[model samples]
Target: MHHLGVSLIVFACVFCSAVLGMYLHGRLPDHHLNDESMGVVKLTIGLIATLAALVLGLLISSAKSSFDTVNGEVTRDAANVILLDRILAQYGPQTDDLRVLLKQSVARGVQIISSNDRAQIASLHTLDAYKRGETFQRKLQELTPQNDMQRRLQARAAEMADEIFALRELGLLQATGTTPIPLLVTLVLWLCIIFCAFGLFTFPNATVTIALFLGALSTSIAIYMILEMNTPLDGLVRVSLGPMREALTVLGQ
Candidate 1:
């Protein structure tokens, strides 16, 4: 779902609850429920909070999954490209020029992945570059006979293409799926205010002692961290491309 759509849904939910609660309070004589209803309300809130935590946990897990998938794809794609470069190198003088081109392609790809914007990638002429790889592989067919090693190399090249496409798709999904930080901030702030209002409505015996506050605060902070990670390349929390860097370091090209 789009971040804006989700934000609207969240806002609607909170707004409905607040309006309903206010309506209930207004309809009551002296704004009081049955004398012994405290236990029920507390139990309901506890259950609701528990369920909210469960849903929030699922959301966090989903974000983590997407982040890992994107990172893993990037790493695998980079490694595959490097392996393809080496396989082409095995053609020696016959494919040396093609190998050089592939090497340059891999280098430029590394530079693009390290970038935070798409402009550099566009300037690299990705489509034209991909055609170069295809041409190199086609040339390899005439140079290297169908030996076991050749077969394996060909399979690896194809796999590399798959990984590259998957990584591109994953990157797009990650960029689009991130929850807007502002929406989160608004959601949590309103919830806290609503909780405070609930406490205020319960005047005489109401207590939000330090210990309870601390526990709730801790959980909120954790969810906030998950939101940060969901944002891909933004903020302190992020998905690592350590494996990509490792391959780049290995080539030293």
Candidate 2:
């Protein structure tokens, strides 16, 4: 299921469980609602709550790390695009057509990545971008430079093209993958259990109901944030396009 949907379900389940607990508290035997029973329930709840908190923290950290890594790759790729274009420019007028194609490829890349659609993300895995890089390499290869300097520039440009292609491949791999769904499910289950325990122990009062609601809401928001960070491209938080936009400007010059 989508992260947003899962988050909502979690919130609803916890909220409903709290409400049900309040209703049940009125009918339960006095002994079951006694201090001793409540104490034991609280103890169990504490342990479960601690575990849930740790897991959630780890998930946030992991998602943040993944987001940063992918964002860095994208920035590096854009920088490489500009660097390769500059190299071709230095290679003399023979590469003018090749430079234009490289710029077009960069534009294509920007368009493809700007969209958050699943199909657009899937397209990243194909050779559409790589084909353009390959064309640049082929044209560079055909050039017969008159001097050592020009020959070296051609080699460097070729190497840059290869690097750009490799980076794109890595970016695609990272962008398409996500945090494990089963792990998230387990976390949500733990949260449900913890909230259920909370309901069992607490008296059904206004303050308790409000507290329980707030806790569930907060937990749901945290999960949503983690999911957003993991997806990066299509969420409340997204990877910035500053680097790509800058590259586009440089290409225009």
Candidate 3:
């Protein structure tokens, strides 16, 4: 499901659970509403609440860390690309075609990343890009270096190309969703139980309902943010494309 849809479902489950608890409050036997029963309920809910909060904190931290790592990798890859192009340029006019191919590859990558379409982003990880990269590598290896300087430049360019390819694969793997669905479901379930406990202990009124509504909405938004951060390539909280785009502009110049 889309992040927003998942969030909405969370909100509905939480708020409705609270509403259901309120209904049960009025219908339950008088003994069930005793002080001892209420105390036990609070204690159980407290434990669940603590667990939920811890899980949420861990998820947010993990998502943010993943997002930052990918962003840094992309920036580093862009710099490497520019460096490789310069090396090829220094190798002489014989590398002109190689330089053009390098630019095209970068341009294609920039276009795919900028689109923010999941399908297009997935395409980047597919065999098509891999084949193109292999072809580039094969051509680079076929170059006949006439002197020591040209030979060294060719070797450096090949190394940089391999590094770029590895980084690309790493980024694509990171772009895939990292959050476990079952974990999220369990968290939402805990939240719903907590909210229901809140309603069970309090009388339903406009003020209580509004408070529950806001709480549910806030929780949903938090989940949404976590999901967005996990998908840094195709969502609102995406990694910046400025580095790669700038590199594309510098290519073939």
Number of the predicted model whose TM-score against the real structure is largest: 3
Off by over 4 Å in 2: none
Per-candidate TM-scores read: 0.60, 0.92, 0.96
Model 2: worst 10 consecutive residues (lDDT sum): 124-133
Candidate number that wins on TM-score, 1 or 3: 3
Q: Which residue pairs clash within candidate 2?
A: none
Q: 3-118, model 2: which lDDT tens digit per residue?
A: 78878987998787777777777778999878998888888878888988899999999988988988999899989999988888888888888888888878877877677676
Per lDDT, what order, best first? 3, 2, 1
In terms of lDDT, model 2 sits at 0.82
* CA lDDT, candidate 3, residue 51: 100
Write one digit per residue (lDDT tens) for candidate 3, span 35-148.
Answer: 999999999999999999999999999999999989999899999999999999899999899999999988888888788788998888778888999999999999999999
Query: Which pairs, if any, clash in model 3?
Result: none
lDDT of all predictions: 0.56, 0.82, 0.91
Q: What order do you get sorting by TM-score, best first? A: 3, 2, 1
Give me candidate 1's TM-score against the actual structure: 0.60
